[model samples]
Target chain A: MSETLTIFTYDWVPKGPRGFVRDLRLRWAAEEAGLAYEIGAVPFEDRQPSHFAHQPFGQVPFLTEGDISIFESGACLLHLAKKSEILMPRTPRGEAETTEWVIAALNSIEMVSVPWWFLGLSGDHENGLSGWLDSRLAHVETVLGGREWLVEGRFTVADLLMADVLRIPQVRARGDRPASEAYIRRALARPAFEKARADQMAHFAAADAKRGEG
Target chain B: MSETLTIFTYDWVPKGPRGFVRDLRLRWAAEEAGLAYEIGAVPFEDRQPSHFAHQPFGQVPFLTEGDISIFESGACLLHLAKKSEILMPRTPRGEAETTEWVIAALNSIEMVSVPWWFLGLSGDHENGLSGWLDSRLAHVETVLGGREWLVEGRFTVADLLMADVLRIPQVRARGDRPASEAYIRRALARPAFEKARADQMAHFAAADAKRGEG
Candidate 1:
């Protein structure tokens, strides 16, 4: 436990583009878990090789703890949940349920919704969420149907990841779509999430100010 | 423990397709852990509803163990590996290391490779993994670098999932290339993988036969 967990990432908030929004999930998980960690900002070009060795997929948010390295934001978040206390609940099934929401956030909601955001951000959403995106979002809206959080009745890693995923510009742009709106608000309401988002924002702002000074 | 463990999956084989390959990984984990399980094949199209209820993401090969439902091929494989023996190493760092490989398989390899195969199956891969595909193949080939398996000193769930991800048709087609060819051979050498591949082939044959009959 002496070795600090070093997280490889690019600043994701306060206004910089980064890997999938799930990167913020890792940030939130770290904050929620109360485990102090280091973040390494890898430039877009470096996300591939030098970085790819740590992550074969060339995605961001790879975790390096001691000699143990992990990729996949889902994998990293859950690992931190098991090792730490904040983002996860206290039961086997509870953790498993958290994972379910994580998968839903990533594979279902994040996959399509994130793209929708990217499309809107890049003005390329014409090829909307189909082949699984449409129904997935509808299901997401329904799942949040009446709930404020994702599972077992409290905020957990699932909500962190889901909230981050839903925060995508396009997904949020769906404002007043009932489920979508409620889902986003539910996520943003959590104090832990708010802190995490704020932390991400500050990190980017500091980096930007540094760049400006440079 | 009295309740039946229902595995929502296609009557799948290991080597045939990606979905089935993943199912076989779960089965192998179950077998290694000495768990009794039943299988259900949700028609391909209906994977959405049946799987959505269980998966939320509406993808296939999820596990319903007693009341715990798990999805995300990597997560499902990891959960079974965790709940069982041998498949996942028990030591904290060991488990974390193995999990990293699982993450790599899903986030890195599975992300692109699986999609590459989908493009082929969906008939959208006319894009051919030529420039990008060739580059990634070479990269995987290299990181695979002199290492035989993805993680740990021996085979684990990481290997199982990585094997499946690496075995994607897109990657398989590249098997003729010196490095990729070598990688596939190393992967196929495992008895479990051999079982998995044969299973996949039979499933493919049956599907082709059914298609011909129609």
Candidate 2:
């Protein structure tokens, strides 16, 4: 229990990705579970070999605790979910349902939305992935319409991850699903999410100030 | 222990997707783990309310075991992993590493390869996602060049899924990564993968005969 849980992310990033850095996923999970943790930083401008040693893709938000190291936000979230029942239910059926939704958010939703967002960056809003992304969003909207929480009828890491994936500004603006909109509002309104978002913003703001002073 | 693990897939499919359906993932895992399981099928053409009840998206390859029902191939793989160490490592560090690579395959590699392939189907072989997909594949190629296996110096479910994702003919033909090619060949060389693929093909072929009879 004395071992520290460290969420690793870039030391600083620009304005665009401030609150949305994936480390927020880890921070939010920790906050929800009341797990003591700290933020560790890798240089945003110059990723070190040690950084890639942790995350093969040079992506942010890898995690290390004790002797265990893990990357991929979805994987890291599952790792944290193992530590606390607050993040996941202990029953086999509950765990299975939770895991399915977690993967659905990562493999199903983010898989399309992230690339679609990237293609749209070229100023072509209705790119090749537009129709596919809409279909995925519609499916999720229907699911969210009927469920207050993703699994076990309560807040779990699945909801945390799903809400994060759906809340991306571009993705949120792409369609008007009242249920999904209300779901995002409900999830973001959580005290744990608020604290995680504030902490991430402050972390970046501090980096900005240091760069200015330099 | 008496619970039967059933992998639910579409009863039939066109030749185009015969060997590539995601249910092969579960079948392959079951074969690898030597777990006793059965295949259950839903009508491919007339997806019923029951099918959607299991898979909100009406996708094939949902799984049910006793009282637990789970969907998402990645989720089913993890569920199977929990039932047998042969599918995953038992140690904490080893398990963490395996899980990270599993998510990497699903969220990182397939996420790009699948959408890229979808867009390419439109005849625009070089689409907006081309550069990004290339960047991802190149990074993976570099990683594969340095290691024979993704985790624990042995074939784990991570390798099974990664190899499955990489072995798509289009993805393999898209680039010249000798290491990735070797890795894919090595994984598919396993009897478990071979049997799973053959069984999937046979299942669809029987469905074809029944359709002809009707």
Candidate 3:
């Protein structure tokens, strides 16, 4: 189990998705935990069989550590959380609280927001999912209004993932949720998130240069 | 830490959601693991702050085990899995495989299917999410065609969650995916699922009878 931690993503994506790619979630977690990791890439234009083997949906941000390769950014984040108390507290109560919030960020929030955003892509921002998204976001705003972080009264990977899910520009602009807005601002302001975003931007930029040369 | 295991759900939901209520997921898991548990109810028409405290989105299917209270069926399943190797494998690799697929069920498949189903409730089955749902289901069809179970050649919590997600009538009827259909059929055929479904139906039916009497 001596292999370096590797996070996989597309070699290049269009400008629209550059900053929002989920690979940043893994990189941000690794940085927050001060863990050394490397980035691996698969062709974005033509996904290979190996990529599909690693990520069944042919999506990005699958992680490999020695013999174990795990997909789903949420699962990968939890895997990393197990390695560092910085990402998640070790106690049973703390861990359960964090795990529930992480799943909430994925199943409850993203499930609504991503589809709402997708439907809005057809220029119907007031689409079928608008009310559902607003309800979910309003619940989150209520939760955030009362707490600085999602778990244990402190920052955890739950905050990292929830903030990432909420920070999508379209979703951010959908309403005036000052608490959620402040939560996202606080999360993105972390040095780890900043470095992760910058590094991801640079990775895609280098891929663009390589594509030009080819 | 000496308390009994308990699952929480609405005391009554309309007949439309009786067997399909998410507490069925927890009930199914407990039945599968042969664990002793009790059912707890919250008022469906009048959700209390206590209910919201347990489930932020005011959703059903949160679980309490002794001192720990966990929400999100996905999180609760994972938590229950930790208690029994019957729900999830004990080995690290086996557990990780089960976990990733569980998250995939929640984040990947249900994320699309649920919203699609919700939009279709307005009589627009061919809404914006149709193609996306088809694509995701097609991937699952491919995977299920190649393997009977979702993880490690055995029944796990991943299959339980996935089967529940895919068992939505509208989503199931969308396309002629024989493999996925067979997979769901096989999962639902389990005695545990049958018992869980019957118990949930009885619970809600009893509530309906009580309402009628009042």
| Tens digits of per-residue lDDT for model 1, A1-214 | 5477887776433343632344667777777777788877666544546676776656677878876777778778878888765577777678777876776666556545543443345465554333445666666777787677877878888887787777766566653458767777777776667776676666666777877841
Question: Worst ten-residue run, lDDT, model 2 chain B?
Answer: B205-214
- Separately for all candidates shown, the number of backbone clashes (residues 3 or more apart, or on different chains) is 9, 0, 0
Residue-by-residue lDDT tens digits, candidate 2, B34-135: 999999999889999999899998898999998999999999999999989998989998889988999999998988989899899988768887887888
Distance from true location, Cα of A214 in model 3, Å: 14
Order of candidates by lDDT, top first? Answer: 3, 2, 1
Highest DockQ model number: 3
TM-score of chain A of each: 0.81, 0.97, 0.98
Candidate 1 lDDT (Cα, 0 to 1):
0.65
Tens digit per residue, CA lDDT, model 1, B1-214 = 5466666665432333444445767666665566777766666644455556776545567877767777766667767786665787788777877877776566555544544565467565554333455666666777666676666667678777776666665567764456556666776676666655465455656755776631
User: How does model 3 score by TM-score?
Assistant: 0.98
Interface RMSD of each: 3.6, 0.8, 0.7
Candidate 2 chain A weakest ten by summed lDDT = A205-214
**Local accuracy of candidate 2 as per-residue lDDT tens digits, A39-66:** 9999999988899889888898998998
Give stretches of model 1 more than 4 Å off: A11-23, A40-53, A56-59, A111-122, A128-131, A174-177, B1-4, B11-21, B31-35, B43-52, B119-138, B174-177, B196-214
TM-score of 2: 0.97
- Distance from true location, Cα of B167 in model 2, Å: 0.7
